[model samples]
Target: MALTGETSTQLALRDPDIRLMLRVRDDDAEAFAELVELYHHRLVTVMHHLVGNAEEAEDLAQEVFLRVYRGRKKYHPKAKFSTWLYTIANNLALNILRTRQRKPTIPLNVRDSGPLGPRPAEQLVLDRHAQPEDRIQQQELAAVVKQALETLNERQRIAVVLNKFEDMNYAEIAEVMGLTTKAVKSLLSRARDNLRVVLQDYIHMNEPGQERKDEG
Candidate 1:
């Protein structure tokens, strides 16, 4: 449904990022810079997950910002600012994925700051007092999880990324992906199922009930 003008204004008032976006629409360079600073790392991280290459992710992230700046004059708050921003990122990431003939390989040494926070695989990271061997095990498990994420199809991966990393609900993810809320739910469900199968072996390595705590 199209948002009524009054509802749009209410959303804008409620979200500080929307207000910053409003400032950007007015050609406020500082506001644009602030928005870039706020989201640059996050966007790059997400793009890295999507494209599976640091260089391509960085370039794609910069392009997303550039598109934002170029289209600033047309900005309007139809939804949360992050939603609009991610919509752009999603479109770009999909384009990149579609153009590739083969799927990219995920690195074994995946970064600690991955999406889905500390699920079963991440839980392998014990306390600060953990021994070096344990830390190494944790890193290995995390990489396996990352590789599992890469196994998902593009749409499923995008849905999982937005839901887990961006903390978006089904409705928000649907808006970004141009799917119905039900479709987003289905996508995440399948993604969870796939991950569960791929990561089953590692789940036992974590403490009890660690896998059950997964959100989205």
Candidate 2:
């Protein structure tokens, strides 16, 4: 459902991004450019993780911007601008993924690292001041975490990527993925469990210096 115009106006006053999007809706070229500049890298990173190919990710990110441009006239601040943006991204990525499922083929440029998140391995990277060996271990652990991420189903992966990388809460993730908050929580729980199982060997081999108890 669309937000009432007055509600959208209230949101636009609160969120600078929504204000910029409103400018875009008004055909302000510079506002659209600025919006693209701000979101380009973030959208690309997300698309790359979702599709598992850098090239495809770039194309998808471009497509997302194109969509925003095309839909400018109909823009409504129904939610945070970022949430609306990612909702588009999630839909596009899932469409591509579903297509792949129908006709499986070897992805030519599959990325090694999965979407980075605040898992135990990621916690190891929080210490900015680390020895060379520690950095190496962090890199290796990140790769392992990425691999573990690949073990999850697509919805689980999307939930994790948005929650971990985008720093979105469960409600935001739920909005992006078009799921209930309860469903989002369940999806994340299952994804975490799957990652724990996959990474158990690595975790045991290299126990984290400090346990991380944070969760969305």
- What C-alpha lDDT values do all the predictions have? 0.78, 0.79
Assess the local accuracy of residue 125 in candidate 1 as a C-alpha lDDT between 0 and 100: 34
lDDT of 2 by residue, 79-145 (tens): 8899889989999988888888677665433342334444334443343335434544655656656
What TM-score does prediction 1 earn?
Answer: 0.76
Which residue runs does candidate 1 get wrong by more than 4 Å? 1-8, 102-136, 208-216
Q: lDDT by residue for model 1 over 1-216, one digit each (tens)?
A: 224565767977888888998899998999999999999999998998887779999999999998998888888787778888998999999888877725434333454435644543345333323543355365565666676786788899999988788888898889889999998888999999988876665666676654334545
Per-model TM-score versus the true fold: 0.76, 0.76
Q: Which residue pairs collide in model 1, if any?
A: none
How far is 180's C-alpha from truth in model 2 (Å)?
0.6
